[model samples]
Target: MPAHRYSELHTIPFYECNVNNRISIPMLINILILASEHQNEKLGVDQLYLIDKYGIGWVVTSYSIHITELPRKDSVVKMTTRGTSYNRYFAFREFWLHDQDGNELVKVESIWVLMNEKTRKITAIDDDVITPYQSEKVRRVPRLPRPGRIEPEDQMTSKEYQVRWSDIDFNGHVNNSRYPEWMLDSLPMDFLDTHEPTNIDIRFENEVKYGNRVTSSVVVDSSDNDKIKTVHEIKSSDVLSASATIVWKENKAEGQD
Candidate 1:
């Protein structure tokens, strides 16, 4: 495996959290993306660098983030990442979340695939990029199941967009956090402006790139007045990039009926 790279420390802001004063799932994804970008930048082999040097693209085909303890606003947090291994078509990475005192918070694992820019087809990982990592060998057992369940959602209320330049990450793909921006944008302004998300579960299935037209769909359940359930999905044509479930809790202020 490659020598350990630096783990960047990031502070949580109130806006990063849902109405519950805890980090939002989407924001957490952003943290991971940020850590990965920071590590690559430090290594001098970051995403854009990779693309400009090589005529290829990388997409986060899968991600599994386990939220152990949610960090609150102003909480000092640390994100650690390591390139684990690669075999055949997959490159693996592991991430750990730590609190200020060095207590473990969350653990994450992900895999990404390289693609040809012209054809937009997934290609194998090029040695030029993978060789430096010298990643450890990982067993191949048909990796874990990814998050993909296709069901029609309510008519998307909000169509706010994320420009190509703004959302692109070091990998030349839309950063994971951008998914949440599309998801939340479809939500009622009143909902996110005042409430917070209690929990969010999402799976990264594919990568949507610059100039890719993405549509956000949401389905909401109103079983309880105080709590609401929402599902957010981002798609291009028939292929899905990611799907998310967000649970919202109203602010603690009086009269939120």
Candidate 2:
């Protein structure tokens, strides 16, 4: 199997950046996924090809992202993605964002699974679908670390959101990018304004369809003023849809807290 890696250069636009002129994590996530979409198109196994031919599509199950520095507005950065390995049920992939000088800015490790289009159930990866990426197949599946659990007894700040049509991707489920946005939005504005995430671990357990209402709940642990940890969960009709843990560092740069 040949190794297939893809990279693309992007200029950060103003809208993609936050109040501090740095690119937001959710937007960066979308860009990383766009890079993967381009790679699939290049390999001729894009969503359309797979769905039309095999009645299947890829869905993200989990992501572990590390942020060294967030790219600022108008900065040109290179985004790269590749399939590390896969098995019958899962595919492991990696993504990296590098600055103009080649310094790593962000790193993302992810797990993906194939889902049947009509049945919306997890499906096995077929040789025809997995072969084009040249990803190695293993009999033993990798054990990725799961997100820290959020106990029901923990006090939480929560908000309700109605899924909009735009939130649905081509797969007919909520876009993976929206999970972090919902999670982050549940935090207090002051915390979000004064802090930036350094590490993020999120797991998607169930799919949320358009028009469904979801409650985003968060628990903040501020015991460490410098390094804060926040636990987040998204639930619809009492079913847990997604959960995430974000580690943040205080932004020393002069700004509103």
Candidate 3:
């Protein structure tokens, strides 16, 4: 079956933007995620329906994102998403953000799996549960590139964060969008203000529960003048929960552009 696409227009809110007046990465991800959830609702497969019917909910496993530029605060943009395909265990989805003139600003490819809410374990995706999206079914699972790991030789810095109640989503775990925020928070403010991520690759390994104190470790490499790379790992009690690598480019000064 052909894939179904859903799209919406969004005005980037002030709260979602960073000090540079561009939409922040984590909130931008949240917006894209909401678009997908909205699509599922339209397909009669929303989270409430899934959990109530099959005791399962959608969990994101990984995301690969590329950015041409970030939309500024109060800017109207079009966000589009679709379920590309699915296998026995994994589903592939795509998302895109375009400016007012239809110029592509960001593109993302993501992988998702069904998790049993009670067991907190991966559940086999039942045909009926996913067929509503009209995604193609295939026997072979798709392989997404894994995020780069932190190297033993790399110098690292760490930050601790307490998972607040607000961070929990309907899935009862730390929202996937918050993972990036935690990872990014480990960086220096000067770096964040001057650099903007151009590419980000992140993978979630374990679910973090409320009240858990998670540690984010990061290693930044600025050897290349053109682009800076940062590798990150998030752990709770030394158990790896997530990891990511982000490539950034220095932004021009506020008034220069």
Clashes of each: 6, 0, 0
Better of 2 and 3 by TM-score: 3
Candidate 2 residue runs with Cα over 4 Å from true position: 224-226, 254-257
User: Deviation in angstroms for 210 in model 1?
Assistant: 7.0
Q: Model-by-model lDDT, in order?
A: 0.72, 0.90, 0.91
lDDT of 3 by residue, 11-96 (tens): 99899998899999889899998899899999999989998899989889999999999999999999999998999899999999
RMSD of each: 4.9, 1.9, 1.4
Query: How do the residues 45-109 of candidate 2 rate in per-residue lDDT, one tens digit apiece?
Result: 99999989999999889999999998988999999999879988999999999999999999999
Task: Please report the TM-score between candidate 1 and the true structure.
Answer: 0.69
Candidate of highest lDDT: 3
Stronger candidate by TM-score (1 vs 3) = 3
Residue pairs in clash, model 1 = 18-196, 18-197, 19-195, 19-196, 19-197, 47-170
Model 1, span 125-202: residue lDDT tens: 766776655566566623644443435544344353544887886556787778877888788777776666655656
Relative to the true structure, candidate 3 reaches a TM of: 0.96
Return whichever of 1 and 2 wins on lDDT.
2
**Top candidate by TM-score:** 3
